[model samples]
Target: MSIPPGESAPNVSTGELNARYDKFVVDLLGVIAYGELSAFERLSSDARYSPTLHDRAALGRMAVTEFEHFDVVRARLAEMNMDVELAMRPFQPSIDSFHDRTRPADWYESLMKAYVVDAISGDFYRAISEFLDQKTREVINAVQTNDESGALLQDRLKKMLADDPRLASRLALWGRRLVGEALTQAQRVGTEHSFLRGLMIEDELPAARNEVSTLLAQLTKNHSRRMSQLGLTA
Candidate 1:
């Protein structure tokens, strides 16, 4: 409950005194947890796009890993004495909208989401993971990382382009849109959150304003190189 007119309770328990610490833990983790859930749904639904048994199994395995992360978040919330549903509710719309509006049409597109979109998300999450406390750090580390899929993503992008040169241009455009949408979503949250805005600024120095731009530029260049290997436009 909120503090009474003349009386006050601390913003967090004495045990949880770091306001920014607690905020980062709750905000960043909740977002990551929601992503796990969405990934599960997207992969399960989109696996049908795959033409081969091996591709379908790979996507299913990725979805299963995402659900595993979801389970970790569920248990972590209970330990924190917070309601998981309450922590998760406000995020449903935004997360749902992000995945919904970017549905992939084929197997390649699905892997692209798993690769490009998920990699950028990992970059963002890793940024906030540093601010958390010990237990929080352990939890963050325990949560899933996409190293396997990430490696495969790079390999597959090269092979796809080598096999069909014309596929490169279309995939390049698709990658650009995917990155752009993710940045727009990020910009939406950054403007709406003072703590995150401050933290991002703190993370960058003389070029704080250009930090995200630079990161995106790097992502685009990497994406473009991958495209070129496929004989696609940057």
Candidate 2:
């Protein structure tokens, strides 16, 4: 991926990379790719709940965009001689569990779930990218790039809450539930994957617990902004 000169990442010494750091990169990329693929599937399936043909088509397009991101991450992994599927395999259970536990009950619920999850993922990726080489960090940021999907969802949700004032409370609770479930799954992933869990400790970035707290704090702030955009309480 040839980024524009203006979009280039900070220069980092390639010599800083070692076998362990390489494993970390491969594993991180694999999980991110798998998450994108899973998001594509979920969004496509959830499109069934769209009330109008246009909405359905729009959601389908969003799903396609997610799959495109998955392809990008997969290509990056392959360039490093890692099998994409193998890289993603370790994260499957945690990701699946998160989705299973947070199944949406309606079109609005699905939209909110997508919004909340994507916001959290974006925050997490931005913070975690610091542990990566410049090129790898750029790849991760590319996958997290926002498009019209967020704006579309935000508009629809704000209108929905306006139409039904009671929805604000329910959806706010739903948002909190989604965050709780997401954090739970994240903790599980860290516990199960030693390399992933040790990314901070081994790299001597900072205390892992403190770093996680900071990540959550950032996610909370972003989540509140998204909720406010949707005319809901945080």
Candidate 3:
């Protein structure tokens, strides 16, 4: 249950709020660390599908960077006195299921998955970072701000689409499907984790609902913009 609106809710103490915030930070870090680890694995696997040696090497580099990001978050979790693996375990199923359902069929689809799907997740993390403490916020900002992979993916995808305009329709459909699966994965995570849910809501039901709606809208808009960047319809 959520915190009820106005007088209907019990008064919450400073201690309670601090504890809640601490749990939220730990939960957030855990999920991010797991996500990076998963990305590293996926990108490493995806590299084998690369058409050229240069592309394979580029993906290998990106995968290494992903592992580096995972280590950063893992260290933060350690500092919080949290068991890193235990903290990340709860999120594994939902994230794994998302990837299983949306596994790409080819190199082009893989590129779209890497670019569109990962960017939306990054956007979500950036949005949530607004509500976290300074140190936690800094950690998230540092890891999420990686531009080399994004730039590389964008350049390659744009050129691919330009070279074969016929691919646009298929890739656009793939992008839409990926976003749908991603949202389902996110919903499952939020439902299972009350502390994460608490971070997204307010003390009032209506306001909280509105906040969530606004956040989804913003995410969708950003996704559409990303699709347009690749010359695809969202």
> TM-score of predicted model 3?
0.91
Runs in model 1 lying further than 4 Å from the true structure: 1-17, 195-234
What clash pairs does model 2 have?
none
**Model 3, 116: alpha-carbon shift in Å?**
0.9
Highest-scoring model, TM-score: 3
Worst lDDT 10-window in candidate 2: 1-10
Give me the runs in candidate 2 sitting further than 4 Å from their true place. Answer: 1-17, 195-206
- Please provide, for model 3 over 14-110, each residue's C-alpha lDDT reduced to its tens digit, 9 standing for 90 to 100: 5565666677777788889989999999899999999999999999998998899998998899898998898899889888888899999999999
Point out where model 3 deviates above 4 Å.
1-10, 195-197, 200-202
Model 1 lDDT at residue 110:
76
Compared with the true structure, what per-residue lDDT tens digits does model 1 show for residues 103-170?
87777777777777776776665554554456766776667565787676678667776787777667
Model 1 Cα RMSD, 1 decimal: 6.3
Per-residue lDDT over 23-142 for candidate 2, one digit per residue giving the tens place of the 0 to 100 score? 777877887898899999999999998989988998899899899999999899888988998999989988987898899999889989988898788778778887657898889888
Which of the predicted structures, 1 or 3, would earn the higher TM-score when compared with the native?
A: 3
TM-score of each: 0.77, 0.87, 0.91
Leading candidate by lDDT? 3
Listed per model in order, the count of residue pairs whose N, CA or C atoms clash below 3 Å is 1, 0, 0
TM-score of 2: 0.87
The pairs that clash in candidate 3 are none
Candidate lDDT values, in order: 0.66, 0.79, 0.81
